[model samples]
Target: MADEKGRYSNAFTATLAGIADLFRKQKNAVVLSDDDVITGKNILITGASSGLGFEAAVQLARRGAHVYMACRSGIPEKGEKVMQHTGNRNVVMLPVDLSDIESIKKLVGQLKEAAVKIDVLIENAAVVPSGSRKTKQGIEEMFMVNYLSKFLLTRWLLDNNLFNTDGGSIPRIIFVSSESHRNPKAFDWDGFGKYKEYSMGKTVELYGYYKLLMTTYANELARRLNPTSQHRYSIFALCPGPVNSNIARESPAIFKPLLKIVFGIFFRSPKVAVQPVVYFAASSDVKDKTIDYLFLMSRKEMDAKATDVENGKKVWRLSEELLNQHGVVFQKSFPPRI
Candidate 1:
């Protein structure tokens, strides 16, 4: 398995094995203890109420990191569970609805008031609507919560110097995207606002479209932020595979039981699925690995269209335009070069 360089000989084989490790009952291949990784780091994880985000927060907290759980609601109940289970009192619950841009701004204010120096930001919250829905701002719910809020919150954080505020330490931002991002349907950029009918087909396609947008924007955002080798922050987008989570609660009722069976048999649990996410969160090997769109355990290129620089630019400008319409102004540090 070792090459002349003393590294794994076949990258594909190594990648395959690494992904297989995620399905292991005990994560036997993982060697890093919680204390060996994220200790003393201030981490912020959105959507920490349940699923992968919740598990990741618990594990990180156990590692001695101060975990700020940015949840939409249920802070007290979830916060107490996190504190007791992780045995770490550093868990702080923050309330913010991603569908509301105003709530996002309020979230930033709360972060600043706490004087937290964010070392790691995990953009993990997302929703898959069973039918077409609109946020308070009249944007598609999935698009607003899954894609646009990510860009807005990230831009807000950067603008206010929310992360790496200790000045010298590099910060990491992880976007929990999905393999479903490969939806073949073309994005209807002009019709986003008028799209309000509830069809299972459209809802499913929109979910993928929104996830794909995350990669496109992340690629472009990385370009805008990392102008040189010495930038303070890096961005990574990854899919957690088909973890059995509530994200699919919106699926049609008739297939729910069948889908549940299939997922239970083949899909990994949230606890196991979160290992790779936490790995990327505080791992030394991930430092400076900027702008990689990845599968659960390996770096894989997103769909070719997702990396379209022109499309990415369009997405960025549209995001700013949308945010502005919602009474939020995006703060740009380094203007996009391409």
Candidate 2:
């Protein structure tokens, strides 16, 4: 059985390898200009206190975007370092915890009251809990923080017209997903709430499912919003490749040495990983009605079934149902075809 499983995994990974190869060959073939700096654009990036998110935020701010750094805790020293290094005066740090729906709502409400028109929202906050745990809302900690919070926040932003600029340019939503969604293992939606018995592989699989959901929801929301409005909006899912970041620290201590060694050898730096996100957030090449599932460093499109409209709609409905059960209304009306 172990041999058979290994064979199947190998075959599955091979398929993904082919797709990634195609993306790598095609990423730089397309020319993009840096003239489209997000000058005076209001942007919000979650998890900006550290890692890839911090790098992306700093880059955006340096390009003249007004960035709101939404983090779970007060400004960390690392964030100060980023600001100092970038010298971007437009950065505003805001406290937010994605696990709490009320906190998310309050933050959006504050933005609305302030009449802030957000041109770009990078849903980058995530949590890989050390052990099995539940969030304040009783959902699995990883799922709640990684997927649910982002879904709810995107919905709130769209429904409240936060993405609508005064000049009528539609905003963009960029979800920082992973390449692991290409795994062949089926998703365990029902089992997401029960995490105690999960092994490392299972945890990684769950993270893949989260990425699948991100791609699904991004495309679905794009399709839903594009046809109805004249102002253009786009959604993108970006995989930052394997990066040397603090995420590995969340693993069991026994594996820390191995993880560090492996990451140090194979992982890209956070600055390198954040380039694709910066491109998606500010590039004119990714215009209205485009849905891109990109690889890091270059704007390479990845293989994703969630890019399909039907699959995206299905995931969107299920996500809405889940959010509604948690007393967070996703507020967007789905078309009859969905």
Candidate 3:
């Protein structure tokens, strides 16, 4: 019903929905204090080269966290900019193409070689392609970058024990998901990971579907990692609302000018839209919670499909199967509760 009212299946409708959502009065809104900080903690964030991810790096670095910018481009430049803006030399850049499995594996190996134990990992990288395309591994580009890569990367990190899960503090895993995840009616189980051709018209719809897969995985990750009464990790996800960013760079040229105008006038700037992300990363209010979701600084529940126990298990199983079919194997065992 909500999706039927304001489906984010198109750029125009999505923009309108975003603007309307922001103006609604927020209840139980959160406030981040100066005392809330992540000083000396190692934080790895993907897609840190631009948009919400870039601003998040700057703000988190400013809060005294050692920020690792995992990106496909902007290798040294973005890292340099974050350091210059935040005056925190702990910022470092690591390169990885989310569409390629080898690249994801290489990223995991690099962190292992460096002995970098992540205190917080923000899975922020995503793409809105002009059409269907294949990656180096021959999988659908959007499917890999938007959803499967996160599943693979998180598993690799956890299997290798890259998260700093010591008794000192809870390790946080944050997913930069979208409210558009609710647009999809249900899972396309028959075509789960199979590559298919699509045009720009289908991109936005698929984006929401991938976000659904991701949000479900986030729920599943929390369940698998912290099976006992004692919470071993903190898994969080949120929709930062409409960020005026380059995510729509793939849109047709005819609409670019108008889209830019609307985005500039209505959408929240990356600096302002990134508050919820910063809150999840640094605020003390969420550190103790096993899981939480936020939309524009207001707490909310994820879609029912994403939170369903059966759906979470099925997503986890199907994801593992898909990766195995692609010859990417998990080197270590998971927490064995399940």
Candidate 4:
């Protein structure tokens, strides 16, 4: 992988470099300590009840950003915890079930009614299922929870003009991806939302597949948004290298303890792993560099086959079709980037 000189000799080396950058003295690059870049900014983050999402919410709120914690349950308590921890009374919870489209619509309605202008949106909710499970809408649980719902929500938010509508500043849309995405093949277009060979190994494999979809989405959405120019928003994905969270709770019960020990010793804890996500959220280094797949606060090139423009378009088209089938309406053409 990395040579003695610390040069990236290959994909593995590049990956290791990214992870090492994660542990560097974490700092908010956008603000000079005497200044605050995120003060008064509005951010909506999913999966804010725990793990990387929760950590990012806390850090952002601490910086004076108004964070709307969107999760499936325990909103009141989690909101209170975040409020107490950050001393940011602006932190509030909004109910959302990433596995359900109707719930997403409800969230959009609420945001619209509240006239909330979002400056940053973090699509960070995900689940790893050990078995073949389906959502209430009959989609595979892993597919629904991990990628499709976020895809739909991002598109809906943009489609309905719920973000970056004002000419104030460049809004951002960040996707939480994983380095494991590099290990997967091109997305399974036809096989998605269908249980194909179900097993623990298959589930693990599919999790990477969904992450691949998420990685490609940043590129695809960037492509769609770049042409118009005035309404261009920052779009990128970050991989918080191997966080020791409940993400793997779906694994076999026997391996749970062993997995926790191995993860604790080998991988970074969720608290530390969240630095990259937080850094990417408001970092000056990434503000104009859109459509990046980052790890450890650095941009990493994706597999060519996965980042190909044709493949990106295909992914976007399929996502639109799926969402349309579920009754979402695409209203306006994309506007120009500022």
Number of the top TM-score candidate: 3
Global lDDT of each candidate: 0.76, 0.72, 0.91, 0.74
Tens digits of per-residue lDDT for model 3, 195-219? 9999988898899999999999999
The candidate that wins on lDDT is 3
Candidate 1: C-alpha RMSD to true structure equals 7.0
Model 4 lDDT per residue over 1-338, tens place: 11223222333343354456456564433322323358888999999988888888888898889999999987699889888988999987999998888899899888888888888999999987777776778777788889898888887787677786476577888889876666554467786556454666566566777877877877778877777544467887877776767777677788778767766776676767787667666667666765666665555666565577777777777877777776777785543222
Model 1 residue 235 lDDT?
Answer: 82
Misplaced by over 4 Å in model 2 are 1-34, 74-79, 187-197, 228-231, 298-304, 330-332, 336-338
Task: List candidate 1 segments past 4 Å from native.
Answer: 1-35, 165-167, 192-195
Off by over 4 Å in 3: 1-6, 333-338
lDDT of 2 at 106: 90
Better of 1 and 3 by lDDT: 3
Instruction: Tell me the RMSD of model 3 versus the true structure.
Output: 1.4
Off by over 4 Å in 4: 1-36, 195-197, 228-231, 333-338
